[model samples]
Target: MPKSKRNKQVTLSKTTKKGRGHKELIINGIRDAAEKYSSIYVFNFQNMRNSKLKEFREQLQSSSKFFLGSNKVMQVAIGRSSSDEIKPNLHKVSKLLRGDAGMIFTNLSKEEVERLFNEFEGYDFARTGSIATEKVELKEGPLEQFTHDMEPFLRRQGMPVRLNKGVVELVSDFVVCEEGKPLSPEASRILRLMGNMMATFRLNLVCRWGSEDDFELYIDGPGDSDVE
Candidate 1:
């Protein structure tokens, strides 16, 4: 073989070795993460500056239950696992690969997770990016009916609206939703409140373990008799 050909082969070998080492490290990290956490939420962000990303990282760090990992490494780690439970949900995570991703690991029940998501939904982080998911069209459907019913509810919440250029806009100077555009902060706040209320009402438990009967003896009977 020529000298240049030998050097090229050596470089490729080094790259492959590095890739395998990183994959192994990520696999170990995934195993550790799975052992420590029962729920993981993967999120994607876009167009955010390094400062804003750092801010988000700091916020997640305060929670002490979140883990963010490199996509390639994580995928390798996940592939080595035999567990099918977490694997199925991993499909929803492909969207994260398209942009910046942060994974949240929590011991919270699914209802709690949904609540947290709803709470943060209204938070506008400098319009970093659009939800890469399919756009939720506001056609005639449950959402439409809810939006109609919510007009009064919004007004009650101090977000009155007015028709402007064939679109609804908040009347309050503090709350403005321009036509053919995304929601403003105040508008988003009201929407978040509504979403949280709906989510709370429709809370579904995704995964649950342990026995409720373990605490039964701590309570008194219906007749006020001690049931120790």
Candidate 2:
């Protein structure tokens, strides 16, 4: 089967309804991170890769920390209002905790942090429900990429393929995937077999806060415009 976002495991700490203590642990961790680091940022995480995120965390372990959990729990930890605020003006940071978001705390300078985020993005094969950035149409011809024995497998994926003289051949021009439409399970597999990569995974900055400054929103994102 083709890998897809549907199978991606999110890192946000999950807990049972009775495990409220887990929520408390996340809250305390967020508070500690806020106090320990000089600069704090809230980021919107969409279809973030778990393995790449682990690599990213390990790469920045010397000077940065990332915390992701339930949005409501984080909001409570940071304080959505002035009454239970964790730090001075932390409520500003809390406001950006909407959607699938997380916090990144770092001692690095703003310039260096921006550079790190820009350089740290990773790419992966587009999966099911992912849109094709470009059109991939295979003309009627021999497809030596597949072995002769794999003829049945190729045909099962909706390809009009046949083994001719121990070579897979497309009987007609096959539109594997069209631009801007969701790639089907079979199409995703075909795209990867054809070496087409369309998904660029990267984080987006929602807001940043510092001890001396107020939280601010950034529309530019984490410097990855190739993402859908």
Candidate 3:
């Protein structure tokens, strides 16, 4: 009988997993960008929104490059110690990639970068677990903003709402969310329905490194501390 190959097992030893390949790409990219751009900045973000980030990246694509991925991989790309650093004092910048952070390699001046970072802010709807920025209350009256068909949906979200003659009515005063408190899932949904946005996405420069030996820390930036 001919040799059967149907049950043969194939070895994956020569195959690289997608994740590992991606990490390698990121590492190589950072290293290349390091050599291309004169300045590198470590930045941390809050309330991240991918759409806004994509837009921001597009705007700076001509003069800068951004690297965001596994912190460990990024650390390795720039080196984690004085001995292994790809550039002088880059190990210090690696230490700043501890949390929700990334790096930007840019040819722009410090003033220009600072102004851009300070001015760039993206706002969107608040999600559950986010702190409510302000109290949102619905008074006991017809909610003209919502249609009558949304009464059931509103009620399901814990809103004291009902259909009153083809209109959505609040049966009683409803406190959707309180300022300074963590927003609940119900509250988040209600806020979305009411077109309320409470989340602000912004980036803060943690540190900056020059191609040579120059390095500086932004004391007011996020993750400001001694290099680990």
Q: Give one digit per residue, the lDDT tens place, for model 3 in 95-196.
A: 888779999999999999999999999999999999998998889999999987888888889888878789888889999999999999999998998889
In order, what is each prediction's RMSD in angstroms?
A: 16.3, 9.7, 5.1
How high is the lDDT of residue 182 in model 2? 92
Per-residue C-alpha lDDT of model 2 across residues 61-173, encoded as one tens digit per residue: 99999988788998998888877787777876776677778889999988887787777677788889988888899999999888888789889999999988889999999
- Compared with the true structure, the alpha-carbon lDDT of candidate 3 equals 0.90
Q: What is the TM-score of each candidate against the true structure?
A: 0.36, 0.85, 0.89
What is the overall TM-score of model 1 with all chains considered together?
0.36
Question: Could you tell me which residue pairs clash in candidate 2?
Answer: none
Cα shift from native, residue 135, model 2 (Å):
1.0
The predicted structure with the larger lDDT, 1 or 3, is: 3
lDDT of each: 0.43, 0.82, 0.90
Best by lDDT: 3
Q: Model 1 over residues 125-159: C-alpha lDDT tens digits?
A: 32312221222223221223234445666555555
The list of candidate 1 runs beyond 4 A from truth reads: 1-23, 62-69, 80-99, 119-228
Candidate 3's displacement at residue 194, Å, is 0.9
Q: Quick one: how many clashes does candidate 1 have?
A: 0
